[model samples]
Target: MTDVSVYTDPQAAVPTAPLIETRKLTRHFRVGRGLSPKMLHAVDDVDITIDRQEIVALAGESGSGKSTIARLLAGVYTPTSGEIYFQGRAVSSMRSRRDQLAYRGDVPMVFQDPFSSLNPAFRVSHGILRSLKLHQPELTRTQRNEEAERVIEAVGLAPASDLMYRYPYELSGGQRQRIGFAQALAHKPKLILADEPVSMLDVSIRIGLLNLMAELRRSAGVSFLYITHDIASARYVADRLLIMYAGHIVESGPTEAVLANPKHPYTDLLLGAVPDPRAPLSVAVEGDTGEPPKVIDPTPGCRFRWRCPLVVDECHHVTPTLRLLGDGHEAACHVAEPDAGMHATKP
Candidate 1:
C-alpha cells in the first residue's frame, strides 16, 4: 500500500472555510398507504463539507442514499430537515427566482447516463449553447458559440467545428460523455456533483474521463462530489472518501488511510469485496446475507447493526454517531470505536 500522505495531498493549503457544507441534512419520504404511511429516511443527519478544488468521493451500494444526497446538493430534491450551505448561504433560504438560478449556475451536475443527458433532437453544440445562454446571457450569439467551442475542446473533443454539428446519436459513448462535461463547464461552475459519471462507460474509456476530471479540478479549481460504488476508481481520483450505508455515512477520512485501515465493519466488507489476483481460488470473501434493513421508520439502534458482523448488545440499543478516530478520520460503530483494534481484515 502506497503512503497516502505522500500521494494524496488534499489538505495542503486548503482554505479554512468550506465551499459547500451540510448541517445535519435530513431528507425523508412518505411511502405506503394513507392509513399508516411509512417514513423513508433516505438521508439521515448527514453533515459533510467540501473544500474548493477538493475531490470527495461518496461510495456505497445502490439505494444506499448516495444519489439522493447528490440530488439534494444539486437542488433536485428538497430536504425535510436541516440545511445545505453553499459559500455560507443557506440553499433553502434562496426564496427568489434569481437566487435559485444563481445557485444552480454555481453548482452544475454531471449525471450517470451521458446518452440520456444529451438531447437527440439537438446537436452537441446546442446543449452547451443553451447552458451558455442561460448562465452567460450577456454574451452575444457569436461569443456564446465561441465559448461553446472552447469548452468542447477543453473537454478533449478535438476539431470543435466538426463535432459541434454532430447529434447525440452520431457520437460515441465517450464523446457523448465529453459533451456532458463540456456542458457542465459552460457555466464555469464552482462545484460539480458527478453522480457515477463513469459507471456506464467502457473500462477502456473510464480512465480517460477520470483523468479529465482530475485535470479539470487542477486547472479550473472546481470542487467535486464524485458518487460511485467503485472504490478503486475513487481511490485513484478522490482525496477523501465517505462510506455511506443505510442512508448514513458510517466512515469517512483520507481515502488511502480508510482503505489501508478500515475502522467500520461495512467499510471492511466493501474493501474485502474488491478483486485480488493473488488470493487463492478456494479462499472466497463473502458479505452478510439477507436484504439490507428497511429504511422506513427505522429502529433507534445503529442502522447497520442488523447486518454487522461485530454486533454487540450496545449496537442494538445505541445509535452511534460519527466519532473522530485520528487525523480527521471518523466512524459510526460502537464495536469499531477509535481505540478498538478494528484494522482492515477480510469479512
Candidate 2:
C-alpha cells in the first residue's frame, strides 16, 4: 500500500527555527570505465531541515544516499550543486580559511568505525586531545589537559585517568565510541552528523551510547543528524525521521508518526520489513529487487518507480516534489493509500 496527501485540517507553520537547510541539495560523481565518465547521482534535489537540539534520523539502506548527505553536511565532499545554510548563513559561497575552520569547528562528524577513526599508534588521550589543540589552541597546556579529563568523564569514562594511557586496540568498541563522543563534545558543536555512529558496536552496548546521546541532547542542546538503516534505532533516538530511497527522500515527519504510518511505497516496504515482535512480519515488497538505475541527467520522474510496488504511470512521466502536510511532515510519493492515516499519520 502507498499513500500521499497528509493534511486534513492543514495545520499551521511550525514555530521552531531550522538549524540547517539544504535547498535542491545535490551531489554527483563521475563513475565510468572510460574518460568523460557518466555522472552518478549520489544525491539529487533533496530538501530537508533540521531543528536546533533535535535529532533528525536519516534512515535508509546502503547506496540510499543517506551517508552522502551526512558527508555533505560535515564538509567532507563539496556539493556539485545547490547550497547549505547553517543558522541562516549560506556555506556555498564562503571559502575563506576562517570560514572553513569555523564550519568544521561548529559541525563535527562521527564515523561508524571508532577504531579506524582513532589513530592506532596514539594513546586514547592523544586522539581526543588533538581536536582541542586544533580548535582551542589558545588554551594553556594545563587547561587543555583539564578539558580532556572533563569531557571524558562527562562521557562516563569513569576513572578517566586510567583510560588515557590505553591505545585504540586496548579499549573496547563501546569505550572507543565514548572517546569519539568526547572528541565531538570537546568543541561543543552545533550539529553532529553521525554516520551510523553505533552500527558496529555490540547490540548490548549500542543502547548505552544511544542513551548517552539522548541525554546529551537534553542537557547540552546538541543537535544530531544521525544516519542509519535501523528503524528501531531511529525510534530510540530521533524526534524526526527522513526516509530516503535511490538518492531521493520519499517521506519524512515526526518519528512516531512516520514510523507508525509511512506514506510512500518504499517507506511502507521499509516499515513492514523491519523486525517487529509487536506486529506479525510480512513478506518484503518485491519488484525490481536491487539497486537504483543510472543517474546521468536522469529522466524527470520519481526515482523509486522501478522498485515501488504501487508505482503508477504518472510516476514515470512526472517528478513529484515534496509537499508539506502539517507540522513539519512531508512526502514526495505520487500514489498514497486513500486511508492516509494508515500510511502517513500517527496512530
TM-score, candidate 1, is 0.93
lDDT of 2 by residue, 27-125 (tens): 998877776668788899888798777899999878889989988988889999898987777887668987777778778988899879999989989
TM-score, candidate number 2: 0.88
> Between which residue pairs do clashes occur in model 1?
none
lDDT of each: 0.86, 0.79
* Total backbone clashes of candidate 1, pairs 3 or more residues apart or in separate chains: 0
| Predicted structure with the largest lDDT when compared to the true one | 1
- TM-score of every candidate relative to the true structure: 0.93, 0.88
- How would you encode candidate 1's per-residue C-alpha lDDT over 1-347 as one tens digit per residue? 11111112243223455789999999999989978889999999999999888999999999899999999999999999999988777888889998888778778999999889998998889989988898889999999988888888888888898999998999999999888888888878778899999999999999999988888887777789999999999999999999999899999999988888889988988888888999888878776554586689988888887677777899888889999987888999887766444643324
